[model samples]
Target: VGSASIRPPATAGRRVPQGNSCNFGQGSRACVRLRGHALFRMAVRNAAPAVLGNALTCHVVAGCDVAAHAASGDTAGGQARGQAWKGLILRGWLRGGLPCGGQRCGSMRAGSCQGSRADVPMHGLLNARGQRRRVLVPPPLLLPLLLLTLLLPTAPPRCAAATSPTTRPEPSPQQAAAARGCSAEALLPLYARIDDDLRHWAAHGISEQLMDKALATQTTASGEKAIGVLFESGVPYVVSPLEEIDRLGHHTGLITAHLRFFEALRETFGPSIPDVEFIVGTADQPAIRLDRLENGALPYPLLRFCKSETHADVLVPDIHFQMRAFNATLLQQLDVINSVAWGEKAEELFGRFSQYKRIIHEHIPTLEVHGAGGENICHHANFELLFCDVREHFMKWAHGVRSSGAPVDVARQPRIKMIDHARYKYLLHLDGQTCSSRLEQLLVMNSVVFKEESGYHAFYHHLLKPGEHYVPVWKEGPEDVLEALKWARAHDDEARAMARRAQRFTQNYLHPDALACYWFTLLGRLAQLQRFEPGRGRRAYPVVLMASEYLGSNAGKAYVQKHGLSRMELPRAKRVEQRRA
Candidate 1:
């Protein structure tokens, strides 16, 4: 009887149509409507095993007698049975029997698994009662294409988690200390007590736009801020111009040295800080240089000003042309702006204090000075001021020396290039814009350094005492240069001792580690003085320093290169000379 239900009996109305060979039901209009549905189900049932595997093939092969049941007019019973059959098919599909779970997954239309394995032909077949019945299936293949499709994701992946605030990782220990809010908190003690006061300083230089774009990102221990810029290559950071203030005529070497200091610090510390955005101001000198007030108001809270004088939040070393000694070989090769050699420590370049006199003895007279050039006892005044230009104060002093018929040589005119220091026993040191890096270099040379007293000083300056490390000359006039020259000639042994003392100070205090300590200390103090608006805050410098440590010095270089930042050029005596003129 079951077989008969599957293969219905042929009767007067059930006779096969002219081209069709299906027995849908006994003589009835409903039977005509069913048409080729029985044939379609039978063909599919028989052929599907080869395409859909046994798991799915069995469902079609053993389908219920829907045609007979529906034709009997047992509406309630037939509908229940139809639902049961549908459930069976659905279960089979969902159980990984069809590619991408077929229509059973509810993501696609029934029986139309688009892009399914083998594109098995499918159609909705009806029974004798005109109710939808079985779906047609095709022959299976050797490949488990359906299974493969089932394994694939139903929809595209999303990036929502990455952007979610909750998903963001809490900052590390160092980061917590450098967080924007923490930076604001740290500054609370030293800066504006009220919101208006903080804003006042920000408006003066550090605008919120500037903070959001640069200063407020993250913090590092070394206190280096990376400006957003692109390399001739590429890096992954906010790209912006390197210089914040567009003013020209500032010292670019100062900028480069600051960058290298950060790079070296980051290379040293591992995770004590992180990288952050930074913008370099184009100020010609520190905002508050010495006792001279360049600005009557407070500077940007985010700025780490190279302390011009006392009462500064942070103290930064003067541009250490000392960095140049390391690039002795490469300096001549790079472009003008990129030529200020740095990244090497002072101790590394010239050895220890003990070896100073010997090295100076060997390297002195590196080249011969024309016009009455002689040994340490030359006819020309041992004093030679190889300056591109002379300040009025220095000029007046030089004029006085000439008027007094002093033996010292005054190369004060513009275009007077740096000459060899060997032939002369007395070397004259001067300050143009601020303290010169040449001060450090001259102190190391075995020659007697005749320094003019000025308000400007450096990290190693305080350690230098008159008559102990150098011969102090008068800044008001040129008589001091002559007076110092006379003293040096009169007391050769004592003058040499002063030069030795200067060399010792550099050796003991200017090592990279020592300088790094100074850098770290200055940043720490500066962080303590920073203040912020009620909610607005920049990152603590520590975090910025740590990030550099994480990314490493090489990464820093990559960033600079990617942004196509040129090296900061050391101010040439010639340029200053031109400016003075």
Candidate 2:
């Protein structure tokens, strides 16, 4: 271990500092004079533990040569001397003794210790030669004042640990409203009910008397009264004139046209008039009112509509025979003209005519085909060549048949063999003629020409009238004509077979009851009435009846029960109800 030591001065220097170390250990009050003019320097070499109840003082002089040597960059020799000097000062203060004044001062006394005043050094030995140098004193007397300066109030400990700011929120009106419940509204209209017997009369052309009798005994659902009538009839009309013309001949045209016209009229006028049973043909017979017309005649009649209110009748001409004759004559003339104009080798002419004939055969019936002999006779005449002459002749023939006689009343005529045949044939001819004429008129009005070379040509012909401005002209070679004619013949056979089948179907299934049901449904819807509601009030509900029947064995009963409606019988007197205010 290396031992280090610090030596004190023997005499006081020329200018002794007040805080310099002094030596005072001998017993007398004599001062030890030190002569060397060296400075008093102190350095702390090690930090000592602070003594309790002691005041520590550190003094640093401006021009002192205090040299230190530390082993670990801390507490070196000079620093240790400084620390020791501080320790000595602190020890003197703690011991309540005065500090050593200077090298020339008297030795320190033991009883000369009291308070902080004892820590201050006297000024007598602060100069050389023991001269008095204004009696300088250390600032230990101001120690309490220095401590007061360091006791400043620190910031509150909790306040030093604060953070940021805060905020708020809002609401939505739409969200609040949705939480409750709200919606919109609307409005509708109402209708009145009619008498059951009258309702049936208005719908199916049935007698009100029958309906009244049936209803008088008929029972209804509990809490509900019957206020409408139900008529059961099955009738199917030839509704499509074009289709009818294709199936039937020109002779059926009259009836076909009438049917079309009446259907149109009903569409236009039926909605406006209530309580009207529009009838077609003659309604003078009791069977007509009774809804007892024989088979096909009742549904597809030559007459159109019969308005009960005005007793008005719309008759459609029955010209089936006329059209058939017309078509036959025209074809014959065309063949004769082709044979004559082109001679035996007139292949082109023949082909053209053949094509024309094909169109005719495709649309018209075979009985309407004219023979070749007649065609040659009128070949030179323009009208004859064009077959107009044949058409005129056929028209005259139709008129003759119509004017011949009143053979049998359609409704009253029973379905006996000869009688039914006559009625069916006559009606068929009439319907065919009506359809053919309409087609012909339409063609002519449209300026459509039937020329072999031109095929079917149409020109703008305002003079031909609005509905009949388009015409078809045929154009084909002789070969084409022959082929077309053969095709037409084959097709005619097929059409006849289909027609026969249709007639059978109509006779078996399409009855008066069926027609009554169809008409009831149609009129009910037109009148805006509801189907019979049995559980509902006696007030009549506007309904539109559909033509189709309900399924199941008890279809009729089920319909009434399910729909909650009541039905009145037929042939009843009209009921009189007081008008509501």
Candidate 3:
């Protein structure tokens, strides 16, 4: 085998770090050496070179044949598993050479030998013509995380213990408001669109007619799954997206997070947030005012928030995505609850899945093979023939591995375990693709964030102070991260102190009560922009139930029942009047 393999690969001569192990091969013979413990057994069949794109090269592994691995015996699920593994291998999911010796011939250090294909290409990802090709791998594949998590019979106990009921009592709005500063001044910029919409709608005067016009426009804006939620007396109905979620969904968990966000606002602020029908979409987009396309005046209100799982930070904080990182990997198995706060629980989870704990128990005996090095896929990094961006990043800085390999991009990028992020002294937060969701999650990880400067920001960006909450990094080029890395290594204490400050800011200001208060204040401002009364709309759920259609199951009903919020009294919107800004 040559250079094509998983990113952050088990390099040749790199001993399987003892402690935890990953069984990655399919064979009766063991090629594993984790402090000399027999861990993974894989029998690779040698076949023809796998074809990548026209220019990218693929070399044949000595004994690694996709056809044989897919066709037969010990590697179960015959055709299905075979095709799956074959797809993984061919797509460059697992490639590279192994560290041959020891387990195969009782010699601790043996040279590379042929396990299968006699014509194994030891040089590079070269072709028949010997032309070198450069191929940048896609982000990491998600199948490995899914495959590994399924191996756990049940998740370790959630931050909340089910029996004793780790759920905490809800803090009163008055109590929370009294303890925290309730200034809406810092947050007004977060809703600049609301002001723009209001100025536009004021000229039109009729909210009813304005909505009728807006709804017609929305209908044609990609007729996918868009449900509008008319908030009558603080009770939420359902909403719309632009031409994303792809336009119906982006991930069901995010939709639930936003719906529940409205529910939490209703819970904390009562009906003071006026009756308004909002086409609240959960996407990495800006608030939509259809009129922006027309006269730039106030039209029907709509907001498309990035809606990270942590946006639960804007409201409940209990329906957290980070607790189990449920949204990223682990499927829809969100049957998790944190008895403690997510920030605190994160520390525990990090240590629990610590890359240090994977102890692989091997059950197969090694078969003595002739002439083959029987390397354990680690030796494949030698050929500097092809270029890899991540490999280059690693070679240059020699620190800062990608922290969220499991849930985020796992392929082209090298990754560490989900919680291993805490173990990293410094974490780089780049606004990937758009304003990244990584910033929110990283600040809470107790590591210094090398936050790259970006124009995009969330509603809560006002709270972060550069040099206080994070160490700023210039995002001008690829080496921006490299620059930040050198600075942190030079000034260690200052970076650590900033991380402490960020942790304090998150824990003190990001409480469920404080976040709801932020939403509560934002809603009042949101309604001020509405020119017409928002009372006329279809009812979805009573303000008292708190159960949304998005809740999806009886477990939500039970959660509502247990929390004492289900039947909490609601302040009628018809009564309270808000002052015009």
Candidate 4:
């Protein structure tokens, strides 16, 4: 039989129909309103699983029906039955059976089984009717099951305890220290190896011997010892019997002796020594013996050599006819010093140093000369005094000029005018304006030289007149050195300022620390390559050093081809002359 209930009565009565409108008033006629049957149908569908689940629960717990019934409905019998059914459904869901609503049961059932169902008494659904047929569901079961339905494991709430910061494992102090030590150990070996190689090179004859000698003569014990070995053997002293004997012959024997010494040093030192460099003059042709070597064989401390000229060329107009000629000559002298000191090319080294000195002489007055006589001296003597003073002034000027990027042309006229007025007057009218600090110094230095010519005014005037040849007089004095020092001290503040500016400029563009970092990074890359691939080593290649102006010149290309080196592999060549300096 279907369960039925009576509908509640309405207060108002129905009215009679008038024209087209008819009103059915409340309570006027017996109205039979159907209670919502759809809800009952859904409940029946949901309850079927619960009923089946209850039957299974009855098998497990026969007396728990009273509690289930009470929780499911208000009536004692029904509540007891419903409660028992609810308990059964929960148990079934826990065991992976279908839900009470026939949905697929999930992991939520595990929590449901572990909830507070045991606390609720089974007899609580009994009423005054004394009906014991209904099931009484434990209150805990109903509430926890309802929660389980909402809080199922399909999307379980994140466990705060699991994610809490306190649960994370902290690193042990010993482990952290070990890690740091490992990093340091890895870095230390690399740096140590590099330092060891450099030291080996220094201990052998790789460093400049003449430089070593100069340091030995001028510096402390440590400095002297720092390059002592370099000076002892590999270097050929300029005044040696070999130099006299060889004269115009090939210096290959000298070079080969040095190479053999280097080879012996490397063999004695084992793998630490990298290679030996032999710098020679471009005109010098060394003996070549390619057939003596085997393929893939390491040549005992491989030989790397370069050719550079170190002496001043009289034929080069740029050096001979340019401004600051005397200053240029002095610089040429320094090149001789460096070559003797550093085993540099004679002509090339001299040329660059001369150029540098000329620049400096044109800008600063570090050297000066004074005559024994006053303004009343003969014209020739006065001219000599004037020429010496001008030469001194320009020498100092050139130092300052060379330190900057100024052109070396501006100081020529004043240089020539002060030395011999007649030969170089044509240069005076050309480009009167000076644009650089170096140029300004050149002019100021020239002014000082002009002042020194006061005694030689008549001779200079006569020489300046058209078609008269000017004969330069040369003089030497002790006070000139003091005068040069005074001039240097006077411009010391400006020099310091320029030096600071240059330092700042270098920091921005050519910082040594940044360069070190780059080198270290490159080293790391090389190390990585070596580690990843064994047996593959750095290739032996020839390097060509050419002047910047000659880099793209045909002669330079020809030289590259002659050496059997690829143009592509060529590093941007710095001036070999500059390197020597």
Candidate 5:
């Protein structure tokens, strides 16, 4: 028998009737709950595994910067596509909940599970029904659709608009010469970070033995274990099915983003695009241990999405694939008021860093904060008081949790556009699952980023200086962030200058055109390092596949179909240009 609370989501036109409403807090709009039915939830998860992974992430399709939430039906299948995505995420939450308060997992009932309210972690809220039946769930985490909302699309840096930060010490002639200039060609913009990743992989060039092992480990799908793709004459022949980001993958797994990156590469290089077979690493965590390459457990190079410099994985343009260029106004009219922050409130990560919220909350009068998602804090340690509710703490999450219902939610902080972030004097950058994917966007904005220490780094992060680009927030504890906040408040000009300097750097180096160019340079460098002939090995297909056939998810299908990318056409060939080694 269905529980009294188990009910359907609100219809488009009707109000959520009475008790069915997900009452978050006073004055807050209710959170939409999933249809409380086990069979239906199971069916939804099975029907679209691809959409399931990204639904909890909202518009975070690698670089998807929603133009006013894409209300128009034109982008990637309109409203229907979005609703399907919502269902997938809601189901995922129901099926994949991790009970953090007590080790006892409880099934969903009355729009909640049998767990302590405080134990809800950061992702969800659980009710304390001590006598309720406890049934174990899988993986144990309700991945609220967002934290670093949409891997932010960064625009081509505008050199004309940049002013050297006034606080920066004068640069010597040598330093000036080394600085990236706007005149730098977009296709071959070189940075030491990109160079470092390539150089590391090139050193371990796929030996004949290594190639054989890599091929053997390959699964049939685009990213089950690994994927195989061959680019020839600027046209790509996907040798395996592609997977969108699912339970296991991050931004790199977005098939649409991957396709866009390849399409851009093809447009730039044409027939000159190198004929290389590669495995794109889609996970936030690097797959191949660079240190353990000798073990041969995993044999080849992985072009990774995350900055894998420390882990020995090859780095590539990550969010750049999904995102367009950042196009917000060059510099904002600064308010220089309270700082804002958004974080991925997963219980394990958030609870570990909950003190950050506690500190920010304690200092609420001076600090106004907002962001999305949360994880329950307690882990069998307490029956209550986990991640029950912290919305009173402003600007705290990355992306808000998505459910099946209308767009409006009064209970939480409203969405803050990346461009609007410039209005504040400061923005806090925190690590979610890895490095914050939106870091590039935050740096491009005029506001100073109080960046916390994180394990992951993007390839471009190497170009940043802690003092020059952003003020550092120590990971030692939450007290450090408090001190950093005080420092920013005390020395305002330096903060502004630091923001200016960081913006200038992006304008010079992170331009969108520079990105397409960077790919060209990166691929050319990889071509130079490739010792073997492309078609000479057993890996070459007798008849290459149309890249569109590789779409393996509903989202991928919608993306390719929405755009006219389903055609089987080769790019016009171009003369191979000589690249600087």
Candidate 6:
């Protein structure tokens, strides 16, 4: 059948690889060398000048068309053809004469024949007519030739899938940023916007209009003086970002979030702003003017501080810093609670959710009091009092679930478990009296963060879109939580996108460098606003006094005495005249 029945074409010898495994044939008879495999039944084309002009010049046999493999129900024939094809492709690699479009198939090794095996009708090899003719794909050459056909870059195929006519390629920078999602190209723009906003605020004092958006109406005068003196002083202060929680000696868990931010801030911008100080404002009304304290007293002692978060006069740390949890992927699934538990009830609540499904879990109470409280005064005092406890709501939900035979515990679920569960499940983060700092961290995770609407705003709150960035849940009850979870499961892709968007947003706006730059930029603007007196408040002040108690009475007393412009006095206790309105 080789030469007797079929005439040999000019390119036939060149097309067939130097292998005894394959033979020129049209029947299902096994080629002797390929006794274990079936041969491709190819139809030999007549040796005539190719009719297809300017295409690669080569002879092709039309037997069982390779395309037939796709539609053919003959599994045996398909297997034979595939094995034969692999053998031929291997031969092309052994022999150098095969025109793999002049390109070497380095990736296609004998051990690794796995690649795009789509039978590509490739026109290559230039004949004497200077016209291209179809080259019969050799066994080894089949792989490389197919590869060259793809890699040789040409115009889009006429029969290719249609694309929207409105589509235009993104700019290189944006394309690169989109590819990486959170690279500097994407983040730097957000950082620039942050820097610009802070500069605007620093150039001008906190605006009356901006202050009107306060969640709180009143502020402590002593708190106001402490911040004012710190802001006015041309010195850097090293203050604990946890002073707000430490003052009440409660809400211990809240400190870890802010501490993460301060530590990151020190790591990122510490070198740039060596004199930077961290500060937090009145928990109730950071934006309000603190003219009177609870005791109706104006602030004194003039302890120096630069604002850290909440206040615009001083630099503010964004959510990225606060919510940055430990590397989520490396974290283990087993919840770890190494710290001391407040009490037995707290222990039970804060204990690990051993069999918790990868669903939304929020151990923090919907009411007040974030972490559990201990029976002892020291343990009880460690938790911040927001004056609103959601123990009843949590109990109802927990009891209902447990009664239904599924014991649900949202009370404890440690951070490690939270992050681990987040990878494969939806996470529900309920806000207590104020917003949860863990919200940012949770949102950054791969899981969908179902958030209940609240009055609190992090630095990045303005950037969060309801459906686009997070799944919104009502503060009403567990039903809404269930509904939100249902929606997330139904629209899984959208939920995942929201998670990615949330992550990208945090990486951009809350990046350590971005926050650090915001810090310095705010100071630079504040420096312009300062009323510089000759030899007065213009040395690089880098000392920060951080205390939850009266600054003059605590470690800040010495700092105030040494750095205080006026003889510092322990701020007088608020006159008992008018209070508790």
- What is the total number of backbone clashes in candidate 1? 37
TM-scores across all candidates? 0.41, 0.17, 0.43, 0.15, 0.50, 0.39
RMSD of 6: 26.4
- Ranking under TM-score, best-scoring first? 5, 3, 1, 6, 2, 4
Q: Write down the RMSD of candidate 4 (Cα, Å).
A: 35.8
> Could you say which candidate leads in TM-score?
5
**Tens-digit lDDT track for model 5 on 310-339?**
365666666442343343232231233113
lDDT by residue for model 1 over 1-581, one digit each (tens)?
01122221111122111222222233223223323444334533322222221012111211221111111111110111123223333343211122221112211111210113323233212243434344433224412433443454433212234333223443442343333223334333322212322343333444445444344342221133323211110011223333331122233334435554454444333133322233333222333222333556443333333323342322344434334432332223224312222221111111101110110111123211111112131122224312122244344445555567655554434332232342346667765444455666666554567775645445456567888888886444445465567677678678667766775665555544444444433333332333332120333222222222223346445544543333432222110010111
Candidate 4 structure quality by residue, lDDT tens digits, 1-581: 01222111120121111111111123111111111233222222122112111111111111111112111221111111232223334443111121222222111111001112222212211122323323223345344643453344333112233322222333232232232232234333323323322221233322234323323342122221111111111111111112122232233223222322322322222122112222222121111112233563211211112100111110000111112332333222333322221112111100011112111111122222243333221123232211123333444444454366322223432333222221111111110111111211122111111112212111002212211111112234322323433443365444334323332332232222222222222222223222122111222112121122122346434443443323121111210110111
Total clashing residue pairs per candidate? Answer: 37, 119, 32, 59, 49, 36
**Tens digit of lDDT per residue, candidate 3, span 1-581?**
13343332222222211221122333212232211221011112211222221111111222221211110111210111222234335554334322221111111111122223223232223222334433333224544533443353432111212211112223333333333344445434434433433343455553655555555454323452333556665566543332233234333444445555565555444444456654544434233423235555454444443322211112112233332342333222112211223233221111111111111112111111111123121122233111112222322232223352211121323556444466555665644333455566667666676665544445566568888998775334334554565666677677768877886665555444444555555455556555666654442222222225445345444344444334332222121222223
Top candidate on lDDT is: 5
Candidate 2 wrong stretches, greater than 4 Å = 1-392, 395-428, 431-488, 491-493, 529-581
Least accurate 10 contiguous residues by lDDT in model 2:
182-191
The reply for model 4, stretches above 4 Å from the true place, is: 1-257, 260-269, 272-490, 494-581
Model 6 stretches astray by more than 4 angstroms: 1-185, 188-235, 238-279, 282-315, 318-386, 390-395, 401-409, 413-416, 475-478, 528-581
Give the per-residue lDDT of model 6 (tens digit) for 390-471: 3334434655655665424464434354444443345556654344456766665555666756444444565688888787
> What value of lDDT does candidate 2 attain over all alpha carbons?
0.23
Better of 1 and 4 by lDDT: 1
